[model samples]
Target: MSSSPTEVSGGGVFQDVHIFSQNVNCNYAHVDYVLENLKDSVDVLFFQEPPWRTIRQTVSIALVESDIVMGAPRYPDWLYMVRPPTDECNPCVIAYVHRCLAHLCPSMQWDIIDHWDIFVLSLFTPKGAVNFLNIYSDNAHTAINLLSQEVNMLPAFIYMGGDFNCHSKVWDPAHTLYPLVAQHLLEFASDVRLEWAHSSNPGLTHTLHNPDLASSVIDLVFMGPLSMLSDLPRLDLNCCGPLDHVPISTLVPISEFEIRISRMVILRKSPEESGFLIDITTGLWALNVEDLFSPDTIEVATSAVAEVFSLAWNAHAKEVVITACSKS
Candidate 1:
């Protein structure tokens, strides 16, 4: 999974969506480092074997003591999308979308594909809701088998990637033997109209810690036939950072009409913030609380207060465009 990073030309003019995928090996520190460093550059992140632990405890009605709240790590700049475990098994696949793309209305499609190792994320666009899949198949190929079984029911994902943990000549030229698991994996992908995306820096996607063992290419990414990708995926060998698998990323073009690089926001401690505070204070002062006779009246007053806040925000928020370097 370790390869050197090579500088390639940027994506096409309309290719604004950047996707980064990696296997963190369930390490908290590795996951934290990836999100912290790539938050500014990457639009979406697909992680396999992400750390799932108890973040805190909350009051539980079932038990006398507090219940353990187990989950993945959280970052302010990235919206973490993960499906809760149905039983005791922790989910192996998770995704994160940048806060900048909140307008896209990204959501997890648990109803479509509900599995701990497979995650389906849908991003709403003007054209339609496009889905991306993140998966982690163990040596037994449980996730791949499930996908193959549910091929008819699953959505046509535009982008699908993860660590399949299977070696075949299709993805690894060094591996001459084609195993049964590889055949099933390829067949499943073909049924769903997914094609293998070759990496620019081609090499082993998984490495051994010891010098004696040979490395292998198991982690793979497959893109749907209709995906609007701009270039071949890149294997970032330099950024694996204490992980066995290197990071792979690709750029996808957004529709010209939907390409938005700037957004309006009221920065904290700025003049706009001061004005917003003043306007909110004034609006709250004028709020009519006298009509609290019924629940309907209370709802009306709440709506009025919300409208006032929205008006004030729209009035003072400044429009800021994302810099080109930030997308790099």
Candidate 2:
């Protein structure tokens, strides 16, 4: 569950962004397990067929006796991003962003495509916002069709993946004839400047209980222009919890920034605090405010007061770096 930088053969280091994608198959326990156990190992998670259930019941003001507060499971370290569900339909796709990426201001792009079966997660970087699409195309290929129509409107997505429920020779060599819808799927991905990102450990991503039926690689991942530097996605055979579809993960390299771990503070009731207060009073009294009549003079006097306080605080305060082992 570590995110340490990996050393390359050429003595270079890669700060990789680990992304995990899976089809939860409407299981809340699976979602809970992933968020709780995989938070440290994964930076972002894209889930399909996510469970949506009532978390609690509340007193209602309308005709109904009570209203149910329904939502997906929430965790402190992960930002759950999903489309708003209606009475007729719940979201089939959801994306979880770890808190480490909070500073990047990750957001869901509902304006681009407002379908319940699809969601677009955007992470703002120095270059611009990088988008990742989570999808769950059913037997009818609803999400895939929507993607085809909205291909021109999509931003360059670094990654797009989920339970595509599609089988073709393009990804699965077992299939003899290419389905027309599969062709549409490939065309849409290509139109958005995306190419198939083959899994490093290639195998059947989907499994069946009946021994007679053959399993296939329905779950898939695609990469866009922005993800050219990313490592190939891999299927985790061990992580799938009682699900037919295996989880796909990838490491994407991104620019890193140092996190500030310390701040200057004047402890209360300490000698430094007393000195800071005394200095602040003395500096305030020394301010030469001749007139309160003019707006410019008032502005100048206010700025001077702020400067006096800041200088006193800086002079008296001590900087401390807080760590996990530090006590209150």
Candidate 3:
């Protein structure tokens, strides 16, 4: 399923969104393997820790051939990629929005803070536990301090997802780190309101040297709000190649279905809350009812409505509805 970026064009801009993250070295064969697997599903990709020259070539290849978009590093750490024909354009952060969303894309400017030998992709502004701050934090307390300082400067909604290089007990008290990097992460997430996304996954990332204890979840996806993650499925495909650790992939959908599910849960918890009702109303208004009945519409709406009822329906309301329907 390999596709060059040049092969995409449509009546409406591509709306189905996909993201891929890989750490391809100079081995063009590995790059080819990754592109083959991703060409069909992903419109945007984020490759971390690749050689600077290789990243440049990948971007050039994507730009010339595929309708896909690529974000190569201008400096050292971060690169944002996207598929084309969309209107959103940010030089610092690559954005590939559907042409339909071109009007909604905001023109925001990003200022480079610092660059390191190891590439880092900053996911979000710091809030609390769910905020993701991707960095290669060494097993030193000083590294934790540096991360803390950086996270403190971001907004609350930021989600940090990527390699942190530190999985000490301090972050995962159940597990232990030699110097307590885990604790640092815990404190960092607590201060900002970010929670680890794949906390439930049992697999560890660093596999080569520590194969016996190779099940540490070092690479992470942190979220500012748990509500932001409607579904968190881990991709454990055996595509690590020569690398010890396999790549991790997660799905994040900014769809009405996801929004409705979150809204319904809130409404069910506090049915009397004005804010909950208002949110439900707003979500319903934003939803395309016509699409709900369309043959082409996926089952997303049905599940979304069911989830809302599951969260919001009171025992009395459920009984009443059942009785009314039976009588009718």
What TM-score do all the candidates reach, one by one? 0.70, 0.71, 0.47
lDDT of 2 by residue, 1-328 (tens): 2353222234342344678889888899988988898876788889999998998889988847788888899999888888888877989999888887776688898877789889888766654566678889999999999887665455555568889988888899888656667877876776455688898899889887788999999999887544554478889887998998899987765444221134355666999989999999999999998898986677677767767866896799786653211221
Q: Pairing residues by index, what is the TM-score of model 3?
A: 0.47
Weakest lDDT window of 10 consecutive positions for candidate 2: 4-13
lDDT per residue, candidate 1, 1-328, as tens digits? Answer: 1111112225422234678889998899888888888876788889999899999999999899999878888999989988787777888999988887777787888888788899988766665566678989998999988986676465555677889988888888888666656766776676455688888778888887888987899888887544535567788887789887888887654443222234355666889999999999999999889979996777577667767876897899776653211221
Stretches of candidate 1 exceeding 4 Å from the true structure: 1-15, 59-64, 225-229, 254-328
What is the lDDT of every predicted structure here? 0.75, 0.77, 0.40
Cα lDDT over the full model 2? 0.77
lDDT tens digits, residue span 121-145, model 3? 2221111111122343434544356
Best by lDDT: 2
Q: Number of clashing residue pairs in every model?
A: 4, 0, 39
- Against the true structure, candidate 3 has what lDDT? 0.40
Worst 10 residues of 3 by lDDT: 319-328
